[model samples]
Target: MTFPSPKAEAPAQRFQEATAAARTALEQLVAQANEAGWGTEEISVALLEAARFLNEANRKDPDPADDPAISDTPAKEQIGHGELYD
Candidate 1:
């Protein structure tokens, strides 16, 4: 009996396309910032922050397109609404 060929599911493919778009946008932003006289240190910091934010967001709900090599990790504990405003 022949086994089915492994292939990326539709949701996963869409996720990958979205991620690629985001990365391209980020590169464009960096180029614009550089042309605006933003120093490397400042740009690097902003990019790092953006990466951190994305990481946190991904941890909450990982993209279905993520490679199978990426192991799933437990999501961080969400703060209560009241606690957030406190």
Candidate 2:
């Protein structure tokens, strides 16, 4: 597997920045919900779920440059080119 070049790092950095922005926005929404007394059981649960999902996503490792599962062989050289319905 080929590693990513330094040029590829820009997109990852941008994604991290976007994620941080989204988290900040969501935190503001949570605070607003609290101040507005909008925490019904369902709304609270939904908010908790959203927070959990975002936290879990942020905790994950960034995507690796090379994926081991991919083969070096060209696609045309691989088998299984026949029609599926045949």
Candidate 3:
């Protein structure tokens, strides 16, 4: 394994610390929102949008059209009955 240089190390550590602090801040904000009566649906949708934003920001590949790893096959759907019926 390779170690980061002295100059690069501080910035990397700072980034790591910032992300950790942000996670705690987000948790507290979500809890406050919940206590302030934001419904599950609203909170969930907001979080989902945040996730999509993060994915878009960090994605390396903008297109997967020619990517061989992606399957062209149609998805197989599973039908389920109630627990008692099953």
Candidate 4:
């Protein structure tokens, strides 16, 4: 008798793939909704929630080809919050 070695089930991989697909769908939906002149607050909030969900699911940033929505702006910004209180 041979015991099966420990390994991830096929369903686990499928689930991860499904999660990634959902994230891609969401990103495209958000872009379309935004372009269609959907409410700013609604679109912004939805995108934020989607990002949180993907992060929780352990999804990495989409590939360049897959990420048409990638930001073009520089990452760093000088802090301009009011003068420090003495």
Most accurate candidate by TM-score: 1
Candidate 3 runs further than 4 Å off: 1-9, 39-41, 44-86
* Candidate 3, 20-74: lDDT as tens digits: 6666666776787899999757886898799898788669666755565423432
Clashing pairs in 3: none
lDDT of 4 by residue, 1-86 (tens): 22334245698876776676667667777778989999767987987897798786565554545654424423342235332321
**CA displacement after TM-score superposition, residue 18 of candidate 3 (Å):** 0.7
User: For residues 1-86, could you state the per-residue lDDT of candidate 2 as single tens digits?
Assistant: 22233333588886776676666766677678778887656566897798798778666834434435445655665556553322
Candidate 1, residues 1-86: lDDT per residue as tens digits? 22233245698886776677666776777788899999767997989998999899899869847554322422232234333223
lDDT of 1 at 2: 26
List TM-score per model, in order.
Answer: 0.42, 0.37, 0.38, 0.37
Deviation in Å, model 2, residue 85 alpha carbon: 44
| CA deviation > 4 Å runs, candidate 1 | 1-9, 54-86
- How far residue 7's Cα lies from its native spot in candidate 4, in Å, is 17
* Highest-lDDT candidate: 1
Q: Could you tell me the lDDT of residue 38 within candidate 2? A: 73
The count of backbone overlaps in candidate 2 is 0
Candidates arranged by lDDT, highest first: 1, 3, 4, 2
Better of 1 and 2 by TM-score: 1
Which residue segments of model 2 deviate by more than 4 Å? 1-9, 40-86
